[model samples]
Target: MDLEVVEGLVTAIRPAANPTDDGAVLLPGLVDLHTHLREPGGEAQETLITGGAAAAAGGFTDVFAMANTEPVTDSVERVEWLRAHAPGDGAARIHPVAAITVGLDGDALTAMEALASAGVTLFSDDGRCVDRADLMREALHRAHRTGTVIAQHAQLADLAGNGQINAGRAARATGLPPWPASAEAAIIARDAVLAAETGGSLHVCHVSTAASVDVIRWAKSRGWPVTAEVTPHHLILTDASADSADPVNKVNPPLRGQDDVRSLRRALVDGTIDAIATDHAPHTRQSKQRPWIDAPFGMTGLETALGVVVRALLEEDALDWQLLARVMSTRPAQIGRLGPASGRLPQTGAVADFVLVEERSPVRVDPSRHLSRSKNSPFGGLELPCRVLRTVVGGRVAFEA
Candidate 1:
């Protein structure tokens, strides 16, 4: 196949018209709606530079960096610093999401207008939900005026406090406190109402339960402008694996039952879930090696996201490639409000940002091969069918396998 790169924009892509040709499976570069490139504070686990490199290797041409940093990205200066200083080599573009609350304390709202002026398109108090309903309502009202999206982590602190795993038979068998599915569903339900009332865009991050999916579907049916994402881990694994006591299997919004897993998969296939986001929350070995309850709630997902999604969903014919593109790239860009102007493949005059995949190649997931500072993955040693051969950002080769 012949591809023309015109001034860092993909000019054209068409069939070579040759039978024995190695045709490249061209896809719009993956855009991560959720990512934690721990910088400005948690550099011990990850930095913007290293995280950008890792994203490029993972075939991502753009990523939305969460604002749960040490000094929260609640100010315009910090957002500007992240956008300007973020590493770029035709690699992934890093767009910072400013915190919704000051210092992420859930007390006062951040300067949404100032941050929006600095080019921040999204706002969140991720890693922790803004539990105060009044505070969240006010933030949503302000965000609507600023044209910024409010992405909620979707967990009720009081209900989820000290909870480790999904509240189900599995947690009961293990004698652990349950992180009730209602904990997430309740917040989504409430947020959907708030978004409807405030006329704001609401996005739920890393939705884990079947009930939450229903809430999002209901909200969307009402034309409330709500979007939701599911993590790769939640799509592939479940709490049954948690019985082994391996911290790698542990994560916030902990793994749920097989029924919930099936529901999440169906949601992805049926458009109930807007996108598949890699909540690529990386933690150090020391942090991940702690007792299950004590370990930080996250795992490395960037490098393995596409492969796992393809294997668990596409490979099984649960979803087609077009749907994959929509869920992984197109819809995410739309939800993040980065669509037409940025975060899309060049269609004539558009910017060049995309990835080429060797769909038949096998994936051997290994920490040593990953570019992130931490090496914690539940998919370690799991072989997958699809492989990313090359990634292009702004018409430049960011990664080549």
Candidate 2:
């Protein structure tokens, strides 16, 4: 599986006569609308180069790096600065998300129009919810004006107070506080109306609740530009991870029950959910080794995301490859405004950005082999039925296994 890339565009895929998996099962390059390349700080957890390599390993050509870094991305200057600092040779392309509010304080709005001018297509205070409805409304209005989307983390602080796992079983077993499903649904309900009223696009990040799926369905029914993304961890794992007593499973918008997983799958299949984002949050071993309640909320996902998705969605025939391409690449590219450069489908004259997926072979996820600085993966040691053999960008082999 080899190709050529010139000036960041794929030019050819050296054709083979009846090329099998050994040759390539070329699909559009994956695009993650929610990746956290923790650069500009937290380099111990992940740097631009390391994170991009992880994305490439997962067959991604572009990843939107969340703004929850040392200095939140809320200004035009910071957006430009991040672009200047992006990895020059990594296989995956990087698009930095800007914070909706200054410092993500949930109070003041950032310079949305200015940041948009600086090439920010998505904005969010992802680690924390934009708690104020008025503030959220203003942000929605501004996003409408700027032709961008306001992505929200969607957890009510009061409802998620000290919550360690899912509100029902895991929380009861662990005796940690509960993060009720209502906490997430409530925010989505409120924001959907605001997005509708403001005629702005609202992208719900890391959607984990069945109730949230209901809201997204209703919003789309009303023709509002509301989209949602689900993480591979959420699709495959559940609060049962708490049973393992591993802090690596502790993620914000904690894992839910099987019923919620079913709902999310149906939503994704039926197009209620728009994309599959990795939310590839990275954390150092020391940080994730802490108690579940004290550890940070995330895990390195770029490398294992596709395998999980294939196991959960494709193996059971719940969806097809076209839908997979839509969720993993096409839709995300549309949302990020990446055009045909990063997520174009494989074909003659197509942007040579694609991945070779070997569906017949199963492989276990080896955290030790990850390109990410952090090895905190929920899928560690778990075997999936399919593997990404190579990721190509602009005709160049960005990753090969």
Candidate 3:
């Protein structure tokens, strides 16, 4: 398959003679509303080029980059630098999500209006919660006024103190600190109320607990402007899998219990959970190799996102492709305010971005083949039903097989 791009827009998709050689399905390009392109500092873990490649390989054409890097992205200058420095790889388009507060410090706020004028539609302090209710409310007010989104990491630091794993059996068995669901739920509940009252756009990042889902549902029922995302890892894995204390499973908002997993699935199916973000955190092996407690929390996710989703939701007959497109593409585009139809079919004579998913053959994941600098992927050795045959972003062949 060949995709032609001109001026960064897909001009034409020249098809292979046998386009459906392996029963490939053309999907609207996937959009990840949450991804960590660890650049400017964590180059050993990931860079713009490598992270973009990973997103292309995973069938994503657009990704909302989290602002948790060194010299956190909080200003228009940093945001402009990211936009101009995006690698010319024709891979996923990187949308900078600036931090909501200065340095993510939770005290002073960033120039939200100025950043929005610079074309940043989303703001977040994803690795930390805005613990101060007043600050959070002010940010929400600014967001409502600017029509932008404030994505929260949603963990109450005081409640989740020094926790290394979920507060279930896995925590007990590992003898590690417990990360209770209350820690995440409490923040979601507070933010939901703030969003409703202030009429601001609130996006909950990586909904890992059932309580979080319940709160989001209630917010929706109340007709509040709240949207939530669930990570591919959290939707499938459980805290039970964390018993080994393998740092690969260590993530913020920690993998949850079985009920949470089930609830997340149901929420996704029912539209209570809006998008399936990869939360594609890339951490170097030397760092991930540390004892679970001391290791930085993250895992490489871009390469394995689609396969995991297919195996967990599609293969299990829990969701169909249309709904999958909404969760992975359409809704994310809407929530992130990333102009219309990112993962949907481009109208004829319009520029396009999309992916061809080969579903007839199965393939096992291999961590060594990851394009990211980090090899901390959790899907290693697992065989799944689908592979991305190609990804065309803006009519260019970003990745092909």
Candidate 4:
């Protein structure tokens, strides 16, 4: 189909010849619910400029930037700083996620009402769980009243303390501390109840274990206002990385076994999981090159997320384009409360935020070619399907390959 753009709006849509000639598929630009732009503090790893470019390259139009920086995004001042410094219309829009707790300390809640008024639709203490039941309950209450969401990292620190890899055989083989699946599941279960009692929307970020899936499923069955997201890395990769002991595979809520990977896929397909989020954490090369036990946990995903998802779910016929749109775009947009133009289908008079994807050719993952400042992709050197041909944000071409 031919889409005509005028002044940043899609003016018309008409069928064109050979729409499938290049195996081209146009989709609403992807929306990422979880992304770490690393600005205002960690610019050595990434900034709004580099991170937004990477997000556009991955076919994303809008990304909710997490609140885990040096000073922490917990105030109206901090959020406005992010908004003022975000990239121009040529790049993906950055929606600032405010910290649920001051400095992400998890002891005291941030000013939720003030932050919401400042345009923060999501709150989180990501990289640190709000483990205090009193604080969690109070935050949920505020989120419910403000009509925003609380996105939890969901790991009990005591259970996950010093964990280097997934628990069980993988941890045993690597001689690293084991991270129990219960650490995640237990927190999800607790938070789900808090969400229900407080009548607030809860978003579980980076659900990694099969046990976590079961908890989310149960919560949804009970009609709680709960949603969950799974990362592409978690859906496609496994704890087999324990054998390689590569720090690139080291991530928070560390990669789990194949059984968990399969469960995450099934949950995504069956509507048990609402979205696919890239916890796009980036680290400096020096920080990432440290010894396994001392190195930071992260993997750059903004440039490779779409291909990883397509490779994980397409071949099995588990997801068609429409379903793909929901998990990758629409649902995430809803969760983040991004405006109407963010995740809409291609239509006349709509703002053009979309990507043209070439489905026939697969691209080999290369960290060096990525737009992100950091090169820490776990999928490096692997071939993946669906290359993004072009990304348009507000009718402006942000990236073309």
User: Of the candidates shown, which would achieve the greatest lDDT relative to the real structure?
Assistant: 4
Candidates ranked by lDDT: 4, 3, 1, 2
Q: What TM-score would you give candidate 4 relative to the actual structure? A: 0.98
Tens-digit per-residue lDDT, 33-112, candidate 1 = 89999998999999998888888888898899999997889898888888788986676889998999999999999989
Q: Which wins on lDDT, candidate 2 or candidate 4?
A: 4
- Worst lDDT run of 10 residues, candidate 2, spans 15-24
In terms of TM-score, how similar is model 3 to the real structure? 0.95
Most TM-score-accurate candidate? 4
Instruction: Please list the C-alpha lDDT of all candidates, in the order they appear.
Output: 0.87, 0.86, 0.87, 0.91
Off by over 4 Å in 3: 1-22
Give per-model TM-scores. Answer: 0.96, 0.94, 0.95, 0.98
lDDT of 2 by residue, 1-401 (tens): 45556655656657554655554456788999998998888899898888889989999988899998888888888888888888775368889899999988888999898889888999999989999999999999999998999999999887877777889888888887788999999999999999999998899999998999998899899998899999998898888877666888888889999889989998888999999999888888898888877888888888888889888886457757788888998999988888755566665455567788887788988899898999988877899878889887766778998
Question: Over the stretch 301-360, how does candidate 3's per-residue lDDT look in tens digits?
Answer: 888888888777964587577887888889988888877656576554567677888876
| lDDT score of residue 321 within candidate 1 | 72
- Residue 265 lDDT (model 3): 89
Candidate 2 contains a number of clashing pairs equal to 4
Off by over 4 Å in 1: 341-343
Cα RMSD of all models vs. native, in order, equals 1.6, 2.2, 2.4, 1.1
- Candidate 2 lands at a TM-score of 0.94
